[model samples]
Target: MTRASYVRRTSEIEHYFDRTALAAWKRLTGDQPVSGIRATVRQGREAMRQTLAGWLPRDLTGWRILDAGCGSGVLSLELMARGADVVGIDLSAQMVSFARQRAAELQTQRSVPTAGRVDFRSGDMLDPRLGRFDAVVAMDVLIHYAPEDARSVLEQFAERTRRGLLFTLAPSSHLLRAMLMIGKVFPRSDRAPAIYPTDPEQLAGQLVAQQHMSGWRVGRSQRISVGFYTSQAVEVVRS
Candidate 1:
């Protein structure tokens, strides 16, 4: 994708999460009760987060991790509990605010001994000012981008990621296409930003072929599917 298109999409996503869907997202990520469909989505997200966590070292002491697109800081908190010093960045200011509040609450209530900490910020995840990380975890962050844009974003991440990059993408499938069609029926104002489903095999092939990603190799992967949520987790490790 062209830089202008990428920027436009990014801005759209920021507006959706930061303004249009902020309240609903806060509830979904919190302990509040939601509808059955949202319940399944919540469950699926939790499972996916656990799956990503499992891919990391059991003990993350001294690790410097980046939680890209950290919504309300659930994954960031989990990583912190595992002894990782995490930097959680998101495009939504409201989301980052919520994350900071949540983190503060957790730290006040818990006395567990761990080497984990988190600095939540609202900004572009690809910002160079954020500096390098031992690893980066971006859950459901790239699903809005076209395939080529997604790969380009990954290549950018690869440059600063010393060890590995873990992220989720909307997988291309019949069910996913059907879901997209169904989503189109909703009013544009009521619907979330469009999700671009990407073929995992094609994405892997592109990663392998990209000269910029030559130092990295595709690693483990898994797909998580629930009533309304389906995402593929992919790992890329430095060679």
Candidate 2:
């Protein structure tokens, strides 16, 4: 994607999550009651999270992971439980703050010892200053970006990633395309950012063709669908 387009889209996402839908997102990620559609989304997201986590080593002691675009820090807490020192970064400062608060509450309520630590930050997930990691889990983060931009984002992560990378995308399909078109007809105030669907095969081919990603190859993949939520997980690992 062009630099200008990326910047504009990023700003839109920040605004949506930080101001437009903050309360709704909190309820969706929390145990609070939500509408039937959102409930299905919540279930789908949990399943996707588990799918991504299952790709990593069971015992993550001494492993450093990045929860890129970690909304509400659920995945970060899960990684910490597995003994991975995690850094959860999100574009929305409000989301990051909520994540911090949620993490603390869970820690207090559970009274469990976590072998790893989590540092939640509000910033761009592609920021290099966050440092390298053994694995990077970017659940549902790339689904909004155009395919090319999504691939470019992954290339940046590959530069800093040591062993593996896990992320999700909205797979291309006629039904999903129709859904996107239908969503656009909704009132502006009632809409979320537009989701861009991608073909997994094409994306994998692009990754393999990139010279910078020569050492990395696409690995396992899975798709999860529940009500209004559908996402595909793809893994890239060192050769």
Question: Which candidate leads the pack in TM-score?
Answer: 2
* TM-score of every prediction relative to native: 0.94, 0.95
lDDT score at residue 6, model 2, on the 0-100 scale: 82
- On lDDT, the leading prediction is 2
Please give the range of 10 consecutive residues that has the lowest summed lDDT in model 2: 106-115
Candidate 1 structure lDDT: 0.89
lDDT of 2 by residue, 1-239 (tens): 67788888889899899999999999999999888899999999999999999999989999999999998999999899889999999999999999999999888998545788999999988888999999999999899888989998888888999999999999988987887899989986678888899997679668867876888888999999988899999998898
Candidate 2 local lDDT, residue 174: 93
Query: How many steric clashes does model 2 contain?
Result: 0
Looking at model 2, residue 184 earns an lDDT score of 89
Question: What's the count of clashing pairs in each model shown?
Answer: 0, 0
